[model samples]
Target: MSLPLDSPALALRAAIHGALAADAPLAALLGGAKVFDVPPKEADFPFVALGEAVVADWSTATERGTEHALTLHAFSRSGGRAEAMAIAAAVQEALHDMPLALAAHRLANLRATTAEVVRDPDGRTFHALVRFRAVTEPL
Candidate 1:
């Protein structure tokens, strides 16, 4: 049989993007559904962008699976880190322990691992890095 061609990481990212884009609370906080895999050069501040992701085999004796570690970045031009932190919190609320429909795979579990906010070197921009861990099994 030919090998199946499916990427759990990519599927997970797409599901995450869709979920965040459709979250009314997150939309209200960001002023819109300003979630992007690659934000435009002129993209507005206080937006969420998909960041890096790492996936590893998690197969069992009879199950094929993968574990994923993903990062999401929140950027804001507010005077302080409050906006960035708030955006990060909203992302966590929108995703943590939530079910995501992945192509060719099933999301076993997803959890927010950590979040950190910092002032950018520009001195006017704030950034928050939120990380999540998830396990996926082939369908």
Candidate 2:
């Protein structure tokens, strides 16, 4: 069956985007609210983009639920990994264990699982990957 428009994944993504976009510390690190699901062709550096997400059935015998594994990417060209790492830290601070308002679902838990910083293929860019795990139950 097709998932509903307000599926847990979609709702969770929207809530996450909203939270990151509104976080003052994250915005400051990014120089502005540069959180995007799809960054523009000419998107600025040092921005955060919502990356891949995997959803799985987390339902129990009694309760319907979903588990989400989501990834967020931070990009920087500041000559080192510092900027990218800082952006990743801000993202973790903004999201880890934080409550989010998800439409048609109630967030059971959310936490930043892991983060890594690496140089991009071009050799001039630093990329930070932040991953989060979340559980949700239908409202």
Candidate 3:
């Protein structure tokens, strides 16, 4: 078997990007607003893209061949803390459960470093940090 050229981290990123894209109200609410802009309705809550993910090296922690780390920045524009957390939780669920781009990509572990509300100049922003691990079989 041949190893896939793309890394598991890239696959995870693609999944996340796809999930956000499919969330229409989220796209519109956040797309038109800035980092901490509040949305009128709960459904239109924004999912702001802070920046590109910083992937860490693979590690050996369990049965999985390797572990990976991805540092991503994002926020939701919601008024209530519960609403923001719900959105963040949904994001976390997607990252953990989404299928890998390649068959070789397998998720082994996942964690969320930050998933809370933050005070910014613009307003209250829902901030979150998602960390996940994946095992990619070598070709």
The model with the greatest TM-score is: 2
Between 1 and 3, whose TM-score is larger?
Answer: 1
Q: What TM-score would each prediction reach against the true structure?
A: 0.95, 0.97, 0.53
lDDT of 2 by residue, 10-94 (tens): 9999999999999999999888999999999899988999999999999999999999999999999999999999999999999
Off by over 4 Å in 2: 1-3
User: After superposition on all CA atoms, what RMSD does each candidate show versus the true structure?
Assistant: 2.7, 1.1, 7.3
Clashing pairs in 3: 2-139, 3-139
Cα-based lDDT at residue 63, candidate 1: 88
- Please give the CA lDDT of all the candidate structures: 0.93, 0.95, 0.51
| Residue pairs with clashing backbones, model 1 | none
Looking at model 1, which ten-residue stretch has the lowest summed lDDT? Answer: 1-10
Candidate 3 segments whose C-alpha is farther than 4 A from its true place: 1-5, 19-45, 48-54, 59-66, 103-114
Candidate 3: Cα lDDT at 74: 52
Q: How many angstroms is residue 65 displaced in model 3 relative to the true structure, after the best TM-score fit? A: 5.3
Q: Mind sharing the TM-score for model 2?
A: 0.97
In model 3, what is the error at residue 110, expressed in angstroms? 4.4
